[model samples]
Target chain A: MIGIDLVQSTAETLMRKAAIEIPDDYLAGLKTAAAAEDGDLSSFVLEAMLENYAAAKEDSRAMCGDTGCPRWYVKMGNEARIDGGPIALEAALRRATASATSSVPLRPNRVHPLWRTDHDNNVGIGAPEIEYGFEPGGDWIDLVTVHKGGLFGTDYRMLFPSDGIQGIKRFFLDSLVAFGKRGLACQPAIIGIGLGGSKDACMVLGKRAACLRVVGDRNPDAKIAELEDELKDLGNNIGMGAMGFVGKSMVIDCNIEVGYCHTGGMQMSVHAFCLSSRRAVARIYGDGRVAYRTDPQWFTDYQRRETVEWPQAQTKSG
Target chain B: MATGPNKIRLSTNPTDDAIAALQIGDIVYLDGTIYTAREGVYMRVIEDRVDLPLDLPAVSAANFHCSPAATQHDDGSFVLGAVTATASFRFSKWIGRWLAASGAKLIIGKGGMSPEDYRDHFVPNGAIYLTTVGYGTGALLGRGVKQVRELHWKKELGLAQAMWVIEVENFGPFIVESDVAGNSLFERENAKIAANLEAAYEGTKPAVLKRFGETDDRKDEMI
Candidate 1:
């Protein structure tokens, strides 16, 4: 069984990693954006961000003062068993979050929505939200931690089938221009677009598309992947770059994720994973072996499967 | 760093001539003392009429709209990590009065106040806005802090809202968002970008169902 102590320790490490380190994929993407950036102000902003990442690592401090809202995506294999059950696993995660909040010296950004009460530990009623996904096999649990900036760069809209791709593009530009002004959304960012699904699900999907996936990864569907490319080019061509300056580096990458929805409606949501784009992941096996990596590897073929039954044989063959 | 953007170093309690000479888009690094004060501190001083904790513009003329990633230990010593600014537009209502009351000359934060705000409040008060680079550079800023002099109202306002008095040297890399004459860098950039926005949205169409009170004007800013 996977030990609870191991789970807690690993979680603490993930939190620290998420706060201080810019993942390799995102760092590379930002470097590419920086190289292509021409606007004086925009280029300066990108260069400063590059230096900030290095400083964060060398000093072992958070890359951004507003460390963002820390959240978890726990993926478990069917046969996985913990030292305790799911409840114990959750307690371990919570403990890790609180401990790391103080030890990492992260700003206590979480508070009561109305009362504005601060726990100073980043743990309050429903704070540090824990979400889960289950895979088809293996006796292992994957822990993914994402520290995403909570405000701005996210929007939702309800549209009809008649609205089509044009409507999608319109809203996409609208969201980017609206938040990208004065560097509010912190572009050149990873822009995630969610099409289809219910309003809430659309938001969730878009957020996941932005936070969970690494740069340059595309949707499995060819048409959707093509749309992603088109959107990326369109965003960069808006003549806006870092801090909403005149330039061509607004979007480092564009990601689109879709789900089935009501026949008559096409719900859409847009999310931006900022320059920091902080995330880290680890997998704990039944034998107490743990492996850590940056990519969450969240969108497995199984996770996106449309068939009602697990097409085990076909998936294996493929 | 070498090719573009003229850079300057100024004191937190800068002279009027120093402020006047600055131009929008110039890079800046600050020296001397600064303090963190946001909505909570603003509301207390402006609305609640709370007495000033320390001498303002005397101890520091720089008002930073920030909450550092920090914590206090059992022995009362503090550990401050990253330091970055929050959006400053939200405090527009209290800004004029805060500037007047505190004699603040440097308002530092993220995503500067509106052009109107710069003209109406900042210029008249002999103040300017310095926007943090990267809307951050938190760790770099943290490195600039020589000392955390004091933290005020932690029990009353909590860590995020409490006033943090800090002393620094070479504490920046901020962009001059607004100058003494009230010209805003962001607005200038926005106007230039707006000239090309129509072409970018050429093939796109607005949503079939529009929300009430939504403006289709592409130039309109949400801030």
Candidate 2:
């Protein structure tokens, strides 16, 4: 069993690390794009961005000024038990968020929607947004902390079942062009497209896909992989190089995550993150052992990293 | 400021000739002091018809469109943590006009102003919109920020969004987006993009026609 203390502590560690470092894979993507970028000026911009990330890591400050809003993706193990219930776990996560904000020096970015409002601690209603999924039978809890910066904007669109793939293409092409123009998105933008789901499911998938790694990961489904390839090819047409300047390299990569939907309708959402798409994943095993990963492994079915004995604490905690 | 990579230096005070000397697609490094402003405070300045919070002549008369993330100190001072530029195209209405009339030489931010705005307001006033890299906020802030001289409307607008007057030297390495030459990078590229996007959409037609169009017979009509 993962103790409540261990869970909170692990979450805190992951959030702090995410706030400071541009995850290894995202930084690698930037370096690759910089080398391949043809536009002289656009390449200069990419090189400078890479330099800036180096400075950020050296200085122990966040890579981008906008440290972004915080959220969580929790894969709950059916066989695992925590010391406390759901509410307590959430409360523990919130406490970790506050600690990470100050100790990690994450820029206090949360502001109230209304007048004279101040959420000084970066946590309020629905903040540190927690998204969850249940594993049928697992012994470890995985919490993926996503520190989303609002560099590029987020968008969602619902189409009639009639509006299928054409609708997806229209939404995607429009977003890439619009986001590509005017430096709205800091290109080599990673595009995340969600198709064939209800409104919430599509939005979540799109957001996840946008920040998910494109270097090592592969879309197992041939159809989805082809769609991803098509997205990358289509992005080149934008011609808004590096920072929307004239360049050959505009988009870094594109990932599409699909969910099953009824014949009723299709909902699609597009989420864009800057070069520094920030995220970190942490897993806690039954023996109070924990490990952190840069990749969240959201949908991938894989063997566990470390095998640990099932603790007697599970029965007592449950 | 670091040089040798690419730095086109511009002074705080420049004649019309100096401004016009720059062409489209030039990346410039600024060696001047600048005043910072956000939308809320600038809107107030426009509405109230007040002079800038900071004296322009005393401080290079340059404007940087940024909302620095700052924390207050015990003695009412601030240590700036993050100073990223906001998108300048949406900064305000009559921004180019206001900057030109006020004798502001350059505006630094992300996303260039429209060519129309530059031609009408900036060209006549001899102003240029300089654009900086979006994700390089840390590097920009790391270089040449000397002091947080003063702030305006902290109570009304809050610290992060409030207007701040800062002092710096060799403060930039920004691309010339809206230049005195009456050129906008986005506008030029937008034209090229329209051409490419049309071809791209057409290119996807064959691959997606079956799944999307529901049938080959309806494909032609679907597009």
DockQ of each: 0.82, 0.29
Question: What fraction of the reference interface contacts is present in each model, in order?
Answer: 0.81, 0.29
Q: Which stretches of candidate 1 lie over 4 Å from their true place?
A: A314-318
lDDT of 2 by residue, B1-223 (tens): 1233434677766666778878667767666567677566666677676666666655666778776645555588766654667777776485854675457878888777766677777777777888777544554564556777787777666665676777766665677777776787667766654555555565333322234323323111010
The stretch of ten residues in a row with the least summed lDDT in candidate 1 chain A is A309-318
lDDT of 1 at A260: 98
Q: How high is the CA lDDT of each candidate model?
A: 0.91, 0.69
Candidate 1 lDDT by residue in tens digits, A1-318: 889999999999999999999999999999998998888888898999999999999999999999999899999988889988999999999999999999998999999999889988899999889999988777899999998984889999998998898999999999999999888998889998888989988999999999988898999999999999999999999999988888888788898889999999999999999887889999999999999999999988887888899877753442
Question: Measured by TM-score, how close is model 1 to the native structure?
Answer: 0.98
lDDT of 1 by residue, B96-151 (tens): 89999999999999999988898889989999999998865999999999989999
- Cα shift from native, residue B219, model 2 (Å): 25
Candidate 1's displacement at residue A79, Å, is 0.9
Would you list the clashing residue pairs of candidate 2?
Answer: B8-B29
Write out the backbone clash pairs for model 1: none
